[model samples]
Target: MKKLSMLLLASALALSLAACGQGKQTGGVKEPAQAQQGDTGKAPQATSKKTTYPLTLKDSSGKEFTFAKAPERIVSLSPTETEVLFAIGLGDKIVGVSDLDDYPAEAKSKPKMGNLQGNPEAIIAANPDIVFAGLSLNKNSVTKLNELKLNLFQTNPKTIDEAIDRVLLLGVITDKQDQAEQVAGQMKKEKQQVVDALKGLKPEQKKKVYIEFSPGWTVGKGEYLDDMIAIAGGVNVASDLQGWKQISEEKVIQANPDVIFFAKGVPNLEKTIRERSGWDKIAAIQGGKVVGLDDNLMSRPGPRITKALVDMAKALYPELVK
Candidate 1:
């Protein structure tokens, strides 16, 4: 009986030690299944609290403005500015646009303020966070907007390079810097491609080009169209003049350009050019080398100017580009 009790005691002690070992295993090392359900799982991701506002930027006129937050309701007083805003993914933020804005098809539906002379009352009624204007905005209108403590940014891009820079600046102000950089970079790349394609042209290979916006209105040395013509491997015959001005029919006849480009929006433009009294004598008319292009692409300093350059190059040198 004593030997049997001693054996039972020994068995009990071994069982107790086994239980303690199992307990330690359960408490110290978790099973794979338990790990997936507990502290080993991913922690909740923290949200970014970076602020893009209290932003200050200088406009083309060297005037500075500050924004407390990203502009939610932007009023674009210039059609070019309207295009720029839309191109950089800020179309949904636009509250108002100028009367002349028609590109991207959506801008046409936006509330239209007056062109050149913007309606201050209408602009104020829109409750815009910011306003983008051109030099056409009269001094009185600017004063009224100022009196109301409204933010008005003037966009005056004199060259294609400046226009691209403006896109980047707008991106910074609107909290879409990445999108804007992509747009500006693509534009620069496309423009440089065109430049590279035409860089090897000899002086003799360059064609004399004439562009007529209206009946008598032609682009001159300082204008974007003139620059486009030169970049597209053509020489603007009216480069002697500066800015948008009328060239006498006599001078146009003397220039006798190899190609003629007319603004596409003008009514009966091709017919008007063909029926002009002495135009039949012009080389372009004789060779039927007249092409029509979108006036906005040539006029507006926006992202689409690269498209305009491609169109102009194709029109001027069909064999080379194709």
Candidate 2:
């Protein structure tokens, strides 16, 4: 009986020890290393919050807009911004575009949101993160967009410097600063080359160029085209007037421009000025210096402006093809 009781006591002690070991294996004991973390399955917390900035942008019409964050899905409501977007390598992010954005070939593929003034509904439907426009964009529409909580960036570039600055600004907004700088640098180089090419040409060697736009409207002094004409090594014969204005037919004859550039938008324009009324007497008509050019290229302040300069050079100075 005593031996049996002693054996039973030994078995009870072994079972008790086994139970303690199993408890330890099941993680019942506190571990200092494991207690360092607040929770086992929780992910590591972030050190800081993401940084954001409030940006204020002014459009051509002197309107200002503020944004809390950078816009991703941009809707281009102006042809200028569309061209700028493509120039700065943000073309892929364009969610919507205006009907006027015909350059870069890819613009045609983007969803059309109608004209700038009447396309707010389409814009809202597209749900773009931002809208890019020019001075011509309607204030009411802009207000509506704002009410819908869409960010708007309005750009109006009057001079070449402004144009370059606008491109860089767009690049910054789209997070493509390096690409914008490269494009701006290339354009600046091309412009310098144009200026350099015209170094020695005398005023007499330069053609008297007339850039005619509608029936009576023509680009005068203090316009983008005038700057391009001077840059492209041609003297704008109509530089006497300020801005785009109407002038008499007799005045065109009096100026006697050696070359007349008919921008594509002119009404009733034809090969022969003789066919038109009150224009045959002009010196350009007599000398056959009328040249048709794509107005979009000349008017737009995008990367293609350099190409327009080259085209003008080709037209004005055909002899120096070497």
Candidate 3:
């Protein structure tokens, strides 16, 4: 009877051990499966939660600003920002514009605040939900806006990529992300097409080009105009200088660029260039390679920069671009 009892106890212990091992193996397999299922179920919820408002972001000035909700009444103090707002389908939300915001035709109808030195009182009187200002806004104005507790965002893009980023940022703040993405995507596609077309040209093959915003104002390094010039398969003659500077006629004469581009509405641009002393002897003038481009398209840091690239490419390499 003692041996039978011990044998029964040993069999019961063996069955318990086997069941424990099986349970562990089953749990090991099922746990990972359950965890994976849980993660999969959570992914959509996580993704959908993105971009919910009271969104916060640092502006170009590195100041943190929070939007309790998407701004419905926007005041644009920069023409470029105005164009961006309109491009992203926020035109109806625009309550006021700067004196210089004269694009899209509709922007002209908005009440004018002030120019680079934005009128704080005028801006405040507009009762805007948010204000979009340029980098040129004075420190005092910014301080005044801060004192008034006005939500101010700065739009200052030094490059085409920065411009696109600003557009997307505006879209986020205005709840027009999809439209902004579409605009940005199209800009990228168009810019890439220009880049791809110019990719095959060797450095030596690139044409020497000159661009004049006015009689003396020209772009240099660190400017999008310079980037556009290079992207269009041409070298900016004034690139040696930095930023917007007045170019000496002697320097321009020395550069003798193969092509010359002037911003349109420069008051008799062709006539002025043709009449300039010694300019008649320049290679561009002699070859009739001088071209006039739309001022806003080339100068404004907006979605139309791609159009500027196409226009510039057409001007520089007429055969390569249609």
Root-mean-square deviation per candidate: 26.1, 27.0, 22.4
By TM-score, the better pick of 1 and 3 is 3
Q: After superposition, how far is residue 105 of candidate 1 from its true place, in Å?
A: 2.3
- The lDDT values for all models are 0.72, 0.64, 0.73
Can you give the lDDT of residue 45 in candidate 1?
Answer: 50
Could you tell me the lDDT of residue 175 within candidate 3?
Answer: 73
lDDT of 3 by residue, 133-233 (tens): 76557789889888998888775566666667666767667777778778989988888888877777889988999988776777788777788888899
Instruction: Give the candidate order by descending lDDT.
Output: 3, 1, 2
Model 1 per-residue lDDT tens digits across residues 2-50: 2211111111000111222212111111122222344767755533222
Count clashes in each candidate, considering only residues at least 3 apart in sequence or on different chains.
Answer: 0, 0, 0
Candidate 2 lDDT by residue in tens digits, 1-322: 2221111111100011122221211111122233334658676553321223464444444445455655768898766678878887888789898776787899999999886553877888888887877654556877887787777655554455456666666665556666777877887877777677777888777777887655555767766678778877788878889966777777777787877887555445644444656677677777776887776766676666667777777778766411
Instruction: Report model 2's TM-score to 2 decimal places.
Output: 0.74
Candidate 2 error regions (>4 Å): 1-57, 65-67, 138-149, 264-268, 272-274, 320-322
Better of 2 and 3 by lDDT: 3
The TM-scores, one per candidate, come to: 0.80, 0.74, 0.82
- Indicate which candidate wins on TM-score: 3
